[model samples]
Target: MSDTLTPPMQSADCWTRREIWQQPQTLNETQRLLRDNQGEIERFLRPLMEKTNLRIVLTGAGTSAFIGECLAPWLSRETGRRVEAVATTDIVSAPDLYCEGDTPTLLVSFGRSGNSPESIAAADIAAAKISDLHHLVITCNPDGALARDPGTHSHVVVLPKATHDHGFAMTSSFSAMMLAALSILSGVAALETRIDAICQAVSDILHNADTAMADLAQRNFSRVVYLGSGVFEGLARESALKLLELTDGGIVTAFDTPMGFRHGPKTFVTTETLVMVYVSNDPYTARYDRDLIAELRADNIAAGIVTLSAKAEADDTIAVRNLGGACDADLLFPYIVPAQLFALHASLARGMTPDTPNATGTVNRVVQGVHIHPLNP
Candidate 1:
């Protein structure tokens, strides 16, 4: 696996590798697609934004759910609106936990395939429960239920077809949907320029860092812990899931915020565990992140520690360059690239198929075995 850092084009596990490599390019396409539809999207969102006592809920399942987690905080700050991330799984099961009947709500749905039962159920449930519900469906599949359903007060942004990932795990799909949400909600100026910088930074990492990440995957560590702050906390969660999914649960994984990890979660660290800290660019948040790294070094409990940051000082750190002093929200894209690559390498290193690690058919690309119950009338 280390010898073959970039999997062969025709290899069994090529889909994952190819998709991961193609993200920098697809992300640019997503930016262009969003720019092309900026006016329509802004029009669709304006009325919802104008509503008094408005609330925004970002909902999705699995990786899609993590996208909301990543964006909610940033969007909240950018739009100065109440924003929350709720998983479709949670909403489908307990709609009242996150949604309200009277609040003018904007339910932003993030889905790769858009066909997931919970994704559809969440949008339907929000419409049925919230009297002033508006939906902004961001998905890769144009034909998916969320996109095709003729629901009132809904707008769909379908990403390029390439994002409808062929592999069992989502690579391009997740990042594209995330970038779409960012472009629509945040109104980051010169987004294409930022995206180009992000692409260059990630391309460098993909080319230069794969061997190191692959070698790290070959280490005998049985447990991996990913830590970050704010948006990167969601990235940490996504990273942990990627590793867990790719390894077919062969390796145990955990994720938490830098501060949160100190409270009992730190006990998970042992000599056989590897810790990856996503250091924040925000000076205030980076303090806590750096403190945790220092504490971890002092404890020396983990087998190895790696820090990913724009401002890295040590050999063990992976520096993401040319962010052009972008905010944490913008930095999220480049930060997660290494995690994806590590998962691919780890999957191959474990002699598991990256394209389909779930050999037993217990899990699926689109989840199975869920029976969506009808909401009571």
Candidate 2:
């Protein structure tokens, strides 16, 4: 923690900064909560898992949606069941495209507030379309419609209220919900150990790298690009959105896989752009990420490049320590911390109020102005 950094109580955009700083603690708290409720969660999921041909649909809006993307690949491989990441925004508008008429579906809904119109409507649409629909609602707001609704075969996991972010952007809420989902669905035996390692890694990053992150934010880049591979692709999307939202769209941003960036998105890179790559710990994936960083350095076209990695050969790379030899699935939690800090610092650097970046009020905390259509069965 830097002495110059404004205290949460004294800062103009207190909620956003405070929430960002509070993530490591909240993540541990979330892990403890999940452990305490493990019996109930497993009990609910056991019966659902017995059903043959089960299809798990992870759905949410925006950052919430990205959590599904991060989990789908890992969960699919672990559970040997079909896992799909479908945005609530997509399902609400076109339920038929996502939900099958007869599949035994588990719709895992992740919502910070649980109040987004799409959140409620997506669950309704899934129930209407899928004959054997089960829901696992992971959310922060206990009183929100998604949590309060008495839908059939639904189990709601409400995180601590402290996670219900007071800022326009989600900080603690997003990471906490993502942790809960992983703990419940992944069924890793050493989850407590993994949680401790993740917390330490994140805490170290926040403590040691604040100066560097703030310096990066102080740069004069007008555009930012975030790259990742596999499950990290979802994280890259969330990272890009965080920068865009916190900076209030003052900085243009893009997210793509390291290899995919060469196809067309590479053109977005320029002398005024800052590129950040979330390097995978998997040896095969790390090769491509390292190659991209090397190429970017060779070209010297971008203003700068930052790589967040568990392992890196470069001296200046942001290394996340105490990963507890976690696999890619477990690594996602710590990998996201740098991006969150970068977005917060960038917002402050650009004189944007992160707590309410959307000064015009077009974008809201719990999205407004969406009129849910009554689904006719």
Q: After superposition, how far is residue 214 of candidate 2 from its true place, in Å?
A: 0.9
Residue 27 in candidate 1 has what lDDT?
A: 83
- lDDT (10s digit) by residue, model 1, range 32-54: 88888888888898777776578
Q: Per-model C-alpha lDDT, please?
A: 0.86, 0.86
Candidate 2: residue 64 lDDT (0-100):
98
- List the candidates' TM-scores in order: 0.95, 0.95
RMSD for each of the candidates: 3.1, 2.6
lDDT of 2 by residue, 1-377 (tens): 22122223534547887887787778888888888888888899998888769999999999999999998998898888899999999999987788898889999999998999899989888888899889999999999999999399989999987899999888889889998988888773467768777877777777777778788898858999999998999999999999999988999999999999999899999999999898888888889988988898999899988888887565546888766356888778777878887888888888888888887889999999999988756
For candidate 1, list the clashing residue pairs, or say none.
Answer: none
- For candidate 1, report its TM-score: 0.95
Task: Please identify model 1 stretches exceeding 4 Å from their true place.
Answer: 1-13, 188-190
